[model samples]
Target: MPIRQLPDTLINQIAAGEVVERPASVVKELVENALDAGATRVDIDLEEGGARLIRIRDDGAGIAAEELPLAVSRHATSKIASLDDLEGVATLGFRGEALPSIASVSRFALISRRNGAEHGAALEIDGGRLGEVAPKPHPQGTTVEVRDLFFNVPARRKFLKAERTELSHIEEWLRQLALARPDVELRVSHNGKASRRWKGEGDLLSDVRINETLGEEFARNALRVDHSGAGLRLHGWIAQPAYNRASADQQYLYVNGRAVRDRSIAHAVKQAYADVLFHGRQPAYVLFLELDPRRVDVNVHPAKHEVRFRDSRLIHDFVYRTLHDALAETRAGSAVGVADAQPAYDPAQAARPDYNWRVPTRPLGLQVEETRAGYAALYGAPRAELAYGAPAPAGEAYAPPAGLDGPAPHPALPHSDDASLPPLGYAIAQLHGIYVLAETADGLIVIDMHAAHERIGYEKLKHAHDGEGLRTQPLLVPAALAVSEREADVAEREAPTLAALGFDVTRSGPQSLTLRSVPALLAHGDVEALLRDVLADLREHGESRRVAAARDELLATMACHGAVRANRRLTLPEMNALLREMEATERSGQCNHGRPTWARFSLSEIDRWFLRGR
Candidate 1:
């Protein structure tokens, strides 16, 4: 058979294979088109999981009556025209293939009336057969009705899941879009009954929207992030380490208002959470990255789910550093005050139909050194003195230090309205030889003694390591490993990076390499496997931190061993000193293993426990 150009109908059907995967895919394309039309409110009506019927009515700038036919034509889009426009495309539906592709596989009808138009026009297409445009009654907007989706393509229809499953997919996608455009009002109905509604308002996203989209738990545990610099602006909420998920289902990332899945960004987020999250657990967040549209390419994939950045390394470093700095402040007692008064769990507040919660505010940065100095003066001891432990009888009652039964003022300590209430407050007792029970101005604080100490030690070790870089240990006999030419090239090109990471590598042959030295901290690791993994990462991501991560893992182990052991009794002074040290230390909220070091129960929570509120 000789090669020939495919028919127009067949060509559209083929494009449908890429743009229309299921009922959810159709919804995604149509909703994106509506958003691109500058729709403020979109009403979605579906029947049988959008398979039998899908009607989307949007109050947006509708298309002209004369342009109705062109809307169903392939490659005819109002989004972009010239190469410059394509390079900086901002709209969601730029491909212009969705309408024709979708029309080819289903029964489609588009009716629209421009604002102030006396009449509306409708264009019908059934399985790629276009009908003449005719006058129709319509509001001052656009309404697209699709029936029997994929009806012409039995194979495609067969692949669709059950009605409930398809409906769930549609809902999930809508939720993601809702997060990106909180200003766009959206409502969905299934089988003639309302299923979901989001009333858009305000210039910025409200906490209520977060609660409705992500959940109340996330809204309560999330940290507001707003950092702008170096031609990039990242603003959104990131979940605290304690609020992680078993899977990464809740991680919603958007680039320049378009939802995308970029590996470099994802890796940066993972690296940022490396020190705080458990090894297997994933973080939940709704992050938005804003940058010049020209700096990123959105047309890399037909589905438009992925993007390519011009400066991936710069973006990665920026994301990593911003999140890293944010997580660091959560340590010590800097974040304790904010965490204490986080929104309480309210089922009714979350379930309310009207989303109108006030936006949560982020705390102003506090001077770490100044706060540490204040804590040091109040404790009347150095961090080193507080680190040592003195053995005491287990389960023995802790007696307050002499002349410290009540609040005592120290001239060296800064005076404020809440001067008496230190962030962690004062230790009152010990629990189970593992937890330190203390009283704060707000409520009770329970601390994992071992975990807290482990974090303190880990931060100190990291600081020391940072001051005197990684120490390299020369191998008595250099290890030789065979590798592919690509790996060898990477090894040669990244030799400087390896050296900086305390590794010395040299190419001995065309496809072979020799490792002469390794970081002292990672000397016992599988050097060959480590090198292979590092090379793979560098080749793919243009950067690798496996060596540094391995070193950190070893440091974490040392910190764990050096931390205070459970069941080790402590006197009042020792416990109090530990509390003060925790307040002054960084990343003290979590241990090296990502477990939270402490938790606070507000006074109201205590009241509810005993039904005192009733």
Candidate 2:
């Protein structure tokens, strides 16, 4: 066959194969167009899961009567023009193929009246054939109606699911949109009945949206994260480790106000929650990242659901460090339940914790100091220092005291000034020899003794072990490794980064490497395998955490071994010391395994539970 050009309608139908996959895909493209038009309110009316009809109305700056014909033309868009505009497109709908592509496979009509227009105009397209523009009375906005989706393409229509299933997909996509934009009012109607609505909350993002989208529990456990640095800014809410989900369904990332999925960013978040989250549990977050539009390429995906970062390493490091530090500030008692709302905290006036881990009145068996000493001997490293201002090893600084029985109380405090009581409050008694019962100002507190102690020990172990940075163990003979030429190039280029991570990597040939040393903590395990994994990570994310993750896992096991065991009897003073230490420890709300270590039961809730307030 001779080379020939396809008809205009054929070209659009082919593009529709990529842009219009289902009813949900059509909704995504049209709604994005609405948002780009500066629409504050968008009403969507769907019939039969949008297979039979989909009418989208938006109060935005509409197109002019003269431009109505070009609006549905292929390769026409108001979003971008020159190459520069394509490179740094800030709007959500930049590709001009959406309208034309969608119009080709369905019955489409577009009516609009620019905000200041004297009249309105409408145009209809049936099966890619255009109709003359006709005068139509419409408000100062745009209305797009699509009917019989995939009517011209029977093969594609057959692949669509049932009505309920298609509507569910639309709802899910709308949820993603709603999270990224709390200031936009969105309403949905199915079969002429209202299905859902998200009220506009302005640009100032608050927990009300989060509470409505996720749940009251998530908002209650959420930690506000607002940070900016190095030409980038990340601000949103991340649920505490205790409120993790079973899958990645709750993770939402928006780059420059456009929802997207980037594996590098996801990995960074997972790494940040590594130590605190339970095994196999996914953390919940609604994060929005903002950076110069030029630094990211959004043209990679047809749906624009992913982006390529110019400086992936820089972005990954920034995200990891930001979330890591924020989690570090998740001290015990910092989070508040919805019912226990209180005045903003003033850290300046906060009382410094005086954890009385000092010499007890008498000898007590099974002190934490003994556990640390035992582990220090087992690992042949220096005895560790305790956290929360606990005294150091004997004769080094302040030797931590462990009294299985004796009590060492604070000197004095004015009872009237309740601010002096630490956030975890003082332990009053033990329950079932496993739980610690404490009293707070507003209500009662229940704590898992072992879980709480395990977290405290883990933090101390990390500080003591990492105080001097990662230690490297030189191999007796440098090990040779084989790899792709590109991988080998990455290895050679990132030699300094490898060195900082306690690795000595040198390029030997076009596709080979020489490893002279490895992290001391992981030197025994196949160093070559570790090298391969690290190189692969560096190639993609521009950074690697395989070594650190291994090291932390080992530390976590040791911490678990050294933590106080359940069913162990505790003296009043011993329990109080543990509570105070919890108050000062980082990420103390959860154990090393990600389970919450403590829970607060407010007076109001307690009253309701017992029917005292009913």
Candidate 3:
């Protein structure tokens, strides 16, 4: 307990507590070391979930005979030579504590022969007891064998789970590593039988590797994202909203080739999917962020699983904007049609030379104006006519249509070309007073009328609000609220940001602030609670959107109430008009609440339902 130096073995045993938690942790360190050594192929052999034995052979630049002892010495490594090297470490394993700590808890042997060496050397260490190096025959590579892991530390060994559970942990970590380094071939064997193999090819991860690691469903639903600007680059695949998961298990994020879990990055991704994903749903993606190595500090954690960025706000905004823009293109009636965007494979058509796998494009000049004009004449004013009948006052239901179909029938709208049919097509009939059945060129589309109209109205409101800017209403008497000193500092510092959001706040006392005006859209909101939340957000995320969010929420509520209600009948022209507006709107694929607005069933799929082709 006094100021005394601990024995070398005791020091290593203590370090093992941090570096060697389980067989999987040992595997992680060894594999990372192998990768740093420029290994192209790594073969791992495990027994009893790597508790009894773990042998790793890598075709990398091996150690020299003279350096065999130092390789397992504490705080000795060839990865870094100076303080500058530690600042921006490009290698995966540079701590220099892994080998020594691992040796202290197990029976460890390291065998190596550098390229062109006529002979090889081997060293063995049993529970921190080092032995002299001895000559041994080995190929031009390195092989590390560990036996009876944690044999010297019974307490650590007791914490390890069962064989199957430990093996699963190892496999999961390997899968994550495989995603980061698709250029390295990895093979794993358990109990003398091979279990997993990942073939290495190409400078970047291929679709085949993604499919194998994540699954075919993910690969099929994923969209390629490549964006670069402002001294940063992000590229990877993100699944569409329809392919969401129940948990964050599939969200893999890497910062400069190192897998990390940063709250700012995660928050940014969640915000990007805020408008599209349903509540409680998690997005699945494999995103890689690349920036100058000096800009991020990887030394924040021993496991290298967390990173601190010099400009976290910049990084957060970049990630949010990139994914938000990509998802925006999936809106209804957008250039990317749902039917064409979701590709279908045909085995019979594989042999056809002229088969087109590309997404089809509709003609630009389709007389959309003429269609709108025709609908306006029949439906009267847009706000006055509901899908079922003329709009009644608040809380009163409009009379249902005399029949499912309208009283007056109009011919199908004209088109410039056969391919000029709008992506949503033309409405044929109403189903259950909620869904709109439409006929398309190659499929049938069923749309939720209420959901579709809600999305359309929401987008329109947003556009109008943005174009006109936030409208500020002066309060008759300024509202005053007390806050913490830190909150007051933020309020004073971000006065300009508050003004832009249609809020005018002035410091009153040491820890008090006065609000003179509020945004017209959020006039009825809880000003004190909203301001406090905004201050909290600014304190945590370096940015706050509470004002804008409150405004948007109000707009969403208005759109929901104004949307066509259930049990309302939609005539062909009214339905068609809604479809056109949806096509022209943003984020129309889903309503304000993130439920899908429309779905499509291809003709081939319909044929399969009835076995027509068979």
RMSD of each: 8.7, 5.9, 7.8
Worst 10 residues of 2 by lDDT: 379-388
TM-score of 2: 0.88
In terms of lDDT, which candidate is strongest?
A: 2
TM-score of each: 0.87, 0.88, 0.86
- Model 3 residue 420 CA deviation (Å) reads 7.3
Per-residue lDDT of 143-247 in model 3, one digit per residue for the tens?
999999999888889998999999999998899888889999999999999999999884454676787689877876677788999999998888778678999
Candidate 2 lDDT, tens digit per residue, 1-614? 99999999999999999888899999999999999999999999999999999999999999999898899998899888899998899999888999999999999999999988898999999999999999999998899999999998999999999999999999989998988878889999999999999998746366667776777887787777889999999999888888889999889899999999999999899989997898999998889999999999999998888999999999999999999998986667774533334443333222243324323442333343433343343322342233222445576543336543333442322232244456666567899999998876667789998888888888988898889788899999898888899989998899999999888989999988888888998887877887888889999889888988878777878988988888888766567667666776788888887888999887779999889955
Give the alpha carbon lDDT tens digit for every residue of 1-614 in model 1.
99999999999999999988898888999999999888999999999999999999998999899998899999999999999999998898799999999999999999999998999999999999999999998888899999999898898889888999999999999999988888999999999999999988844446667877887777767788889999999988888888899998999999998888988889989989999998799998888999998999999989899999999978988888899887876654434211233322222211111111211221111122223333354343364223322223466524445565533321222222342245665577889999998776567789998999999888889999989877889999999999999999999999998788777999999999999998887788787898898899878777777887887788899999988899988655467667766766767888999999999887789999999958
Preferred candidate (TM-score higher): 2 or 3 = 2
What lDDT is obtained when candidate 1 is compared to the true structure? 0.81
Clashes of each: 3, 2, 0
